[model samples]
Target chain A: MAVAIAEARIGKWGERYYSGRVLQLLERGLIAFRSSTWMIVFSGFFEPVLYLLSFGYGIGKLLPTIDVGGETVKYAVFIAPALLATSAMNGAIYDSTMNVFFKLNHDRIYHGMLATSMGPLDVALGEISWALIRGLSYACAFMAVVAPLGLIPSMWGYLAIPAAVLIAFGFASIGMALTSYMKSFQQLEIINMFLLPMFLFSGSFYPLSVFPEWLQFTVNLFPLTHAINLVRGLCLGHINVALAGHAMYFVIMIICGLFFTTRRLNALFMK
Target chain B: MPESLIHARGLTKKFGDFVAVNGIDFDVHKGESFGLLGPNGAGKSTAMRMIGATSSRDAGVLTILGKDPDKHGPQIRAHLGVVPQQDNLDMQLSVSENLYIYGRYFGLPRAFVKGKIEELLTFAQLEEKRDAKVEALSGGMKRRLTIARALVSEPEILMLDEPTTGLDPQARHILWDRLFRLKEQGVTLLITTHFMDEAEQLCDRLIVMDKGSIMAEGSPASLIKDYSSKEVLEVRFGSDRNQELAEKLRTLCERIEELPDRILMYTEDGEALLGQIYASGMHPKTSLVRRSSLEDVFLRLTGRTLIE
Candidate 1:
């Protein structure tokens, strides 16, 4: 009955591509999540925590403090927010890319959903929203670990959770969009190839100034660079107009990713 | 006459340069069981997809429940329950959850879907397997669960593509009985099948399709009557001699088909034809007499067997 009302409301436009039942897909994902192996889900949450313990704390003893935007901070504090951003990206990308690829190619889940009144846009939105849940939970989990350790020094650090979500939203959107075009499991390896270098060189560990000017410019183009910068600024209380610019990059990514994901899904299943 | 639940005129689809459905026309009325009977790659599944509102027609007119599919795909799809050729049940979910999620996909209320799940489980005869994962079920059970999932929306039209294609004989009979129950309940059924026996058992009306075009359209009995004799006489002297006897056998019946393994003599009376063949001093290794069927109709129309 709710569907009928929603359909009547949006009946004029986008009815061919959307049915306003995206939450139903979320419901399905949640149910499936209950039965799925919890080890993999926990592995995504634990990945950054391990990185923090090893790199942030272990390496922090050797190099005590770093200067960011003229504000001096411990090395552990500087990298904690970046780890949070990385955790969010990893969680969202894993769910959106690998899990979604399996469902799309092997399980044929979207074929079943689209055969109903639900459309391609509903699937794209529903799936991306589910991935965001994983991203959000990981952000919260990372914050829970770092907050007690004095890694977040500023009251403004609370905003990092939302920032992590935004970062997750960007990666999840683009991940699904890219995964839609993948035809085989081997092609999915290309994602990890790009992600590894982005994680290492996106100024997550050290300052981007350490690289050559051309290399720094290339690193800045990575979405992770903006994500790390945005979250780090909030954690260190380095408030500036530049923060909104980073957020806007993700907003544009969200829009473009959604547009292409919906189009690709429609072409693949509804053609 | 009842209004058509589905209408198609010159309906066509193309994948690259290959035409899948080419300028076919048909109408399915409310509460009728309509079949698209054809061999593989005969365009039956393509036409089914267009009417189900999942695939767009490249050039033609298609309307389901009085709305254009290209413009109102979701609205039209809301009235349809589609069972695809493959069993696409979510392996992560159990049987009941599969049905419940499908209902939710149609935007049905949660409480309503929960209630509907029990009824559908009972309808599909999977009540004992409700909590079992889809992967654990047998092929027939999986197919039944898929059908149950399709009915979760209580759709006016149920579109099944090759519903019993891979099932054993007993499983096919069970599926046929379930479909018959749906027909009795007045649900409009649209089925696509390469199995002539399945079409004969289920469809009230059907279109014979071949090479992306409709060869003929009618009820099973009418098609057999129009295109075949009343009965068929099957006689096999041996593989080597079957072809040799084609010319002599051709003179004994209204029509004859010389298959590699056997000779088919079409006549109004198979028993009388056999006696005549025997009187002509022709002794066959084996002989059988049977009533004409959709197989004979298909052979007569296309010069090929339905199963190929």
Candidate 2:
């Protein structure tokens, strides 16, 4: 029974390399993510829940409620979906970027993995799979918190969980791709410099219409903008053909980012 | 049919115009230990990487397990085991987990891998430490675990790059004993190391490599006999007085080497050289006679110390 999988022979070396590596990574990734499960579930769900309770409800008492897409919504409803998107982006990028680099250069776990039948593609895919898994967990927890609060206005908001996963996959791929070029810990400061301003300015906390036209266009370039828009659109019970185009943006990013990341991993490890 | 597990003619590798491994030719027959012995920067590791099907050769015919590395790396590597220079053990996993995961990578079933992991942990002498994380283990333990992980798939050919480097005497002896046991089992082994003692102890036959090329190839005893004399007389005239001392002992020894710290007299009989030195009444400090070993043979052929 143990050798049954070995019966279906791998067609070629390069072809099976990624699949084998992913299998190894998936096993290890389970260990890594589950080890930190308590911290992940607590931080992801409560941070947003607290915001909905304190600022959205508590601070919302200070001002008049605004209308979003012809529907008068509470401040809690306004921020709930955006926070889910934020959690997805945060979980994916954190698990894939810094964690991936540390495992690659310092721990040399992948070096040991590479010595086996596993290849570079397996590493990239396994890492991305873990990132997606973490994204889903966070998204589910965030949505569960919001749904209990009666913040979600429509049934379509449930679909946002998988949508957030696709979005997180996009960000995680780019993050892993970027980590490949970093040679030192000092270089990681640049990742923060790039990620922090995107988090603040990508309309995570506010609507994009508040920004100037040129600034809004620039914010649209950030992946978080589309993710934020898609989730926000779903939670507010707003949908249209435009949301399809917005979701496609994340899909394109996923393909391009994965391609670049796999290529970069091959260049660094195979050499 | 007993065939050559490894066959190569002029295998070479270069990294961006820097020739890491110049064109080289060699072969490893079934179930034999082959070695590449050289100092640092001698391309020994690069050559092993090619045979392990991890690194691509620039311009030579190379086949490992009857398949080209470029085309059949995964298939060929499936039947091979590699122990790299540094112990690249998984820090997050326990000693047994390391072996279990490697077995899984070879597409082994979970049940089969569980049994193999237990067997390998015992073979590596890591059974007691099986549940401990690799980071908690000592250097020798980690290295042994790495070797154990390599054997998880029961590979046909095992490649060890500097198997006992940086190991203390006790650890090195333990590793050597394990390697000898593996050899006795008729597992084909290919190894690379700069330690002459290690080579003499573990290798049945070796090829001395230098500057990305093969300098000489033979058994340890044969190489020593061919390049070096039966005995060496160590004479210390003080580092400052080497030239004058050489002039004085010129006719006494067959050949002399003026080292930075001491002078060496290469002669067939050390007693004759000692008698001549005593007759001259030059009682220098520290004189001893010793049998020739692989270090002397390496120095004679490469014209440099192996350890630099």
Candidate 3:
């Protein structure tokens, strides 16, 4: 079974080199990730739940119900989408950036891989795919628990599985790109400097309108803000055409981030 | 002669203002152990990198498996295995896990790699440490694992860059034994090292490089025969008097090299040379006779020692 996945036949080498190679790379990663500690897989499922327990019921008891999707909803229902989005974001960011930096500079793991048939594109795509898997698992676990508590109101909330994947890919792509250029462990602080602000002000905690008009324009620029908007709209059953724009933000992130990431990875490895 | 697996004419590489590998020409034949023997700053590694299809040459024609590195790096590299100078084994991974990942990099099946890992662990003498994480092993163990990792793909040409640079004498002998086994299996080996004894032991034919250029190229015995004599007679007059004493002994042999502490007389007949020195009434603190080696050839060619 392991052999079959790793030995999937490939067609060509140049340009489309990543097509046949990504799965093997992903399989390699899953083996390493699984064999190591394994505490991560189970522990990762708890971050969102803790947030739900601590903030949802703790702060929810004090605040009155808020209107979402043209109907009054409990405070826990309003905050669940944000917790889910951030959890996915955190999972992907950790996998794509920190682990990547360790592999590239400290461990020199990818250097050994590059000596073989595998190219830089394979490394980038495979890492992002693994990150997406990690993000998706946490997203699913969070949803599974919250659904039992009657937090999910809309049948459309199931679409957040795919939505969480999109957010993970978008952030993981850019995170890997940023890490490709990092020279030292100190440079990793820059990723947090970029992520923490977006997490705090991306309308995950409050509505975008609550911020001033000028500040709302700035909040719209961050991808997580759009992610929160999409998941919130879906979970709250607020269906509209504007949701396409929010979804497009992540798509654009995927395209541009993957583009720059492949270029940077190729340059780093090739040079 | 066997067909050349790697061919180069005036190959060169530069990093900004510093030229790492100068325009040099050579051909690496199939199924023979070839070497680049040089000092620390020599271009052995840069040339090896181009041949491994990873680093592109700045100028001149270079081909690995008859394909240009610039255009077909991955394609050419697919058939080659490289053990870089430094050990870069994944620290967080088990020994077997390292082999598994490297095999998958070549797109090899997991079942095939799993089978190969057992044989490789035995070859590396690391079967006891197979399940241990890499960081927990000793340096020699890690170096062995690195070489074993490179072998997972069963490559056509195995390139080892200074394979035993930091290893102790015992570790180095074990590595050389493993490499000899690979050679017996008819795998083409390309090795680079600054150790004269290592070059003498492993290399069938080698190029002596200095300051990014080839100083001489031949079999180890041929290089010594060509550049040095059958035996060297060493005589130490005290360090303060060696300079004055060297002039008196200059005409006594085919050649003479005076160092800070002693004078070396190169001659086919060391006993004759030593008798002549004693007949002239020059007293030495200590002296010995030894066969000439690649280090003498390097000294003859570059006027500097191979290793400080």
Candidate 4:
């Protein structure tokens, strides 16, 4: 009886573009992970931790404290949220772009999946959700480490976990959309080139005020800047209207990313 | 006539200016093994893709199981088992895991798929390699596993595109035997193959295609009878002499084809034609009389070999 109702619902909603079996892809990813190199999966979680230790502690010793918004906090506290946001972005980007590129071009995994009852939307949502899991885990791991160090000063700081997922979602959706247009591995290198500069200059390590107005405007255009600001605002208890803007930025990114990823997958495999 | 499972009329697909599948029409009936026989770039794979619901047609009407594929692609694909020309198995997963995940993609219950796995493994003869990674398997094993994976959904129509293109003769026979069993079990098969022997061994009915158009359509035997003679005499007077000897050989038989290396004489009695050639004082280096095949039919229809 339950199966009948579910089928009826799926029949009505699918419209030949989705089958509501996105989670099955997650199941496949998890099963595949059992035999995959565990070190690579674990490595994303450590990137932020290493950055915190080397930059937060090493630089924190020299600076002692920094003024964020109106509150004066230890140098480690200010940069911790930025690293959290960066890690979420990094994990999501790596999973969605490089890993997805390999699967799309080399493994032809999506081709096999689309041949089943599953549609392009199912594949897009499933893969993006998997990348989000990696992003969410990195955020949670980063929070667990920093919360013990007293880097998180407010109760609202825990919201950064979901916020980190949003950040991951934004980067993942856009990353996948862009990766779909990539014909060669060298084209993928262009993404990395843009990502490195965005990471280094998106006020991840210092204040955006240090850059010229034109430069700051250019940096603000980078999605990482909004991610860092949003995560930093939550961790530092500097909640304001601007944070909503940052969150809205990701909401828009997610929509655009999903739209294009589905269309591209359909065009590439189903056309 | 017996419940058409697939129907197409004037179906066409174009890539820019190149017409991959021109306006062509055919029907596949229930419990029949249908084939699209053509060489590479003959649009057989393109037509299969349209039937598989993975590609949308540029023009004309196409319906699978009485539903328009363009409007019901996912629903149509749910009933299809497509073995693509290339093996797209998940390299990251073990053999069984590839089967497991594929069933799950169709929303099959875990228990049902788990049960189906053993039956398919036995059928594909891959029970011993259940835990083996796809990359670790040999070519034949990989092909069998791909076919097994396609069956995980218990699909209504099994579509194989060049199912045995790259396997050795032994492996090809084994694969053909498995496909033959599926036919015996009443699975509707849609296959595309360039090898004449494979087509003759597997297809119940077929359409010969060249340059995106159907050149001929019939059962293997009927096509051979309609377009070719009962027997063929292959006489090779050396490569240099083959063209010169073809003029004389033509008058001795109903039809003669001058290939680069040999001259083929088509007749009702190949032995009689060879005797006549010998009586005419034409000494050939070697002569053989054999039954005509789909290869000869293709040659007659398009003036070209099927493999070329």
Candidate 5:
């Protein structure tokens, strides 16, 4: 009976979800990343860091050290955490959306992956994990650069790394879910149109309160708004109970996004 | 043959309004090579997909490995391996990595897959190409690698869709040899193909299908025997005047068919028919007598050529 249970546990369909296959996909993803390591390493780490050097030192020198929510904070202090949020969102959304779509359509990688015991759920989860790993890496590097520059106001900023991962995961899951429905390259332009504007206007560069009341309400609906605010709150060492609401928003988004993405992937590939 | 390993009744698959597989029922016994043979759009691949538990059946009593595919797809699929018509290998990975990752999908430990990878590569004759990327391999090598990858889980049944289509004659023969070895090891094979030669070479029992339904079912030899006469006489006349000669040659054969390219006479002995044609003073450009084959069976059932 024990032998039979062991066999059943290690059986075929059960096998696809095993840590071994997940590890293999993770290893393959990391290996593939190595092939283009320079692109990810430079783009993920340097882009946010470059923005810090350029704007924090170059632009912030001209802007007065402003009072944010009653505390006198440097202009760089206010913007660095927002950069962290945007970088995390960028890392997650880009990898999960465009890269996943290319592998699904042109490379036929998902087709090959599905031919194994790995179901659509496994692929969705695996890709999202990679996105979070990438997002966390970028968040850490950006934090390191900003820390030496005295941009981090308190130790609560360390919590921003995991927060960035959650933020990125929510976007990555939703991005992959949306990518599953897209058919043509021309249609992907719509995603760029949506993503770029959200990055520009959704409080990544400025406070949401700077916008008109109506515009603030509109941008509030965007996932990145909550993510940026959460990181910003943490970075400035302002621990507010309202931060729980932001955390809940990302948690809910991750759940729904993962659920929807898995469903969409299965519907598309398991036919 | 013991109880049927695969049993289906009223199995159907409809894509929107167009019915792809319309209510087919069949069972596969253990350790048998069963085939679904048909032309280009015959739902053979769809049927194979349903049996492989990768596609859903709209309505049916379907059981694979004693489980309902609708509720137990992964369970059913775990015991089965499928090679789709196209070679969907991971172009980024080395040939061995393809097999290794596939084995990992079945949740095999790395050490187990490491040993199996070498054995599988040797079996596929890809030992030298193990480290080469999939994009660098030849077409036949890719197909062999696909088959090897499917075998990584050591499945009980293997499903191949058009396993040898588009392959050169030598490659096709080599694939057939490998498949025959698998059969000798008592692994059941369910194959779908439009190629008559492939069906005849690999299938033990086959169902000829057309337009999403089975037209006939029997052993390859029995199918040829039941649907076709012993021999066929091919006659090509000098010109359009061939029609006039065809009119005169009706009395010399059992059944006469006038095709755009040539005339076919289905008879017991083509030599006697050719002699009668010669003695009757009807001259033709060329004539030949050949034994009827699965090609004849296809032509007789579909009223068209097989390769088309």
Candidate 6:
């Protein structure tokens, strides 16, 4: 009798509750995640913290103080937000690209999922949200590492959680969108070619002002630069008009990336 | 007419310029077991995908459970159970977990799915292997688990494509028995296979297809009756001399099919045909007689063997 009731309800539940359907996708993702050991999750937390320890304290004594916005601050304070922004971007990109690519290709996980009540958009949104969850946890872990070193001083730093999620969403959606165009895992080298440049040139290691006049404009064009500037400005209590500009850039980026990702996934999977 | 659970009229599909399924028509009624019998590359799977609503038809109209698939894909799919030709199980998860997650995919509540897994494990005969990862199972077990996963939502129509193509004989019989139970329970089945014995055993009505077109459509027994004689006389005079002896024994039976290894004579009376062949002063190395089957139906319709 219960089986009949469930079967009867199956036909009545589709389309009206798309969120419930997408949530099913997230639930599936978590099921796969649970099958793995905890060692991978622990490792995601420590890589950024290890980088922070190496760069924040190991090199801070040499640089002494740095000027962020108008106020002078310890070198550790200036770099922590940049590290957080990059950490969020890296975590989101790796999850959305490598993990997603494996499931899309070798595992054919989405192929099986789509054969059910789920659609392509459900898969895209579900995977991007899970990547954001991973990115947010890593950002929080990075903050815990640097907070003991007295790096985060401003109350505006509390906004880091949402900011980290926004940055992660911007990168993760775009990464998923790019992966749909890929034919094989061999094309994944393109992601490395893209991210390595953005990581090195997006003002993660230094201020955009350090670049030459023409190079500074090019540096600001990168999404990570906007993420780093927005996050750094908030962490240091340096509120300014440029902060709104960076925030708007990511908002538009998130919308556009999500739009393209949904369309691309539909084409690749729904055929 | 009985209402069809699946209906397709002039349905077609193409990949680039190559036509995969070219303007085929078939209807599968509720509570009936229907099949598409064809060899490899005969466009059977493409038709299955379009019927399953995973692949849209290139042309024509399709309705599943009284709803157009183009407009209500997810809703239509909710009521469908598709066991694809390949088993795409999640290797990272356990057998019970695979069933649980698929139930959730249909928006079944967690508590309901948890209880459902125990019954499904027993149904698939995987109760001992419930906690085992999907990758650790044998091919037959994985296929059974896939079929069980498709049943989690209690679908109205179960589509199995080449369901027993890779299984051993015993495994095939086991899977067939499970599917037979589902049919007896009045679940509509849409199966595609190149195996004639499977079709004869399982399908109530089926279509013979070759190169993207239906050659003939009828029940298995009716098809064999329409396309072939009641019985077949098989005589193997060694591979080298079967062709030479086929001409000598032509008058003994109404029709004789000269294959490479054996000569098969189609006649109404197998015992009389075999005795007449023996009296023809030509002694073959071996002789036997049997009733005609779906294999003969397919061969008569398409001029090609079903197994390829």
- lDDT-best of 2 and 5: 5
lDDT (tens digit, per residue) of candidate 4 on A112-211: 9889877899988998998888888888888999999999998889999999999999999999999999999999999999999999999888899999
If scored against the real structure, what TM-score would every candidate get?
A: 0.97, 0.95, 0.94, 0.98, 0.93, 0.93
lDDT tens digits, residue span A164-218, model 6: 9999999999888888778888898889887788878887666778888999888
Please give, for residues B123-206, the per-residue lDDT of candidate 6 as tens digits. Answer: 899999999999899889999999999998888899999999889999999999999999999999999999999999999999
lDDT digits (tens) for residues B234-267 of candidate 1: 9999999888888888888768998888989888
lDDT of 6: 0.83
Q: What lDDT score goes with residue A156 in model 1?
A: 95
Model 1 CA RMSD to the hidden true structure, in angstroms: 1.5
Error of 6 at B117 (Å): 1.2
On residues A60-165, what C-alpha lDDT tens digit does candidate 5 reach at each position?
A: 8798586666788888898899889988988888888888888888878877777655567778888888888899888888877789878898899999999999
Ranking by TM-score: 4, 1, 2, 3, 6, 5
lDDT of 1 at A170: 90
Q: What is the interface RMSD of each candidate, in Å?
A: 2.0, 3.2, 4.9, 3.3, 4.8, 3.6
DockQ leaderboard ranking = 1, 4, 2, 6, 3, 5
Question: Which docking class does model 2 fall in?
Answer: acceptable
Q: Which is the leading candidate under TM-score?
A: 4
> Which regions of candidate 1 fall more than 4 Å away from where they truly are?
A1-7, A10-13
User: Which residue pairs clash within candidate 3?
Assistant: none
Candidate 4 structure lDDT: 0.90
Model 3 agreement with the true structure over B27-80: per-residue lDDT tens digits: 988999999999998999989888876676899999877877786666677778
Candidate 4 stretches greater than 4 Å from native: A1-11
Give stretches of model 3 more than 4 Å off: A1-19, A68-71, B237-239, B260-262
- Selected candidate, larger DockQ, 4 vs 6: 4
* Model 1: residue B53 alpha-carbon error in angstroms: 0.8
lDDT of 5 by residue, B141-254 (tens): 888999998888888788999999889989988889989999999999999988888888899999888878777889999998999999999999965877877778888876
Computed on C-alphas against the true complex, the DockQ of each candidate is 0.67, 0.47, 0.41, 0.60, 0.38, 0.46
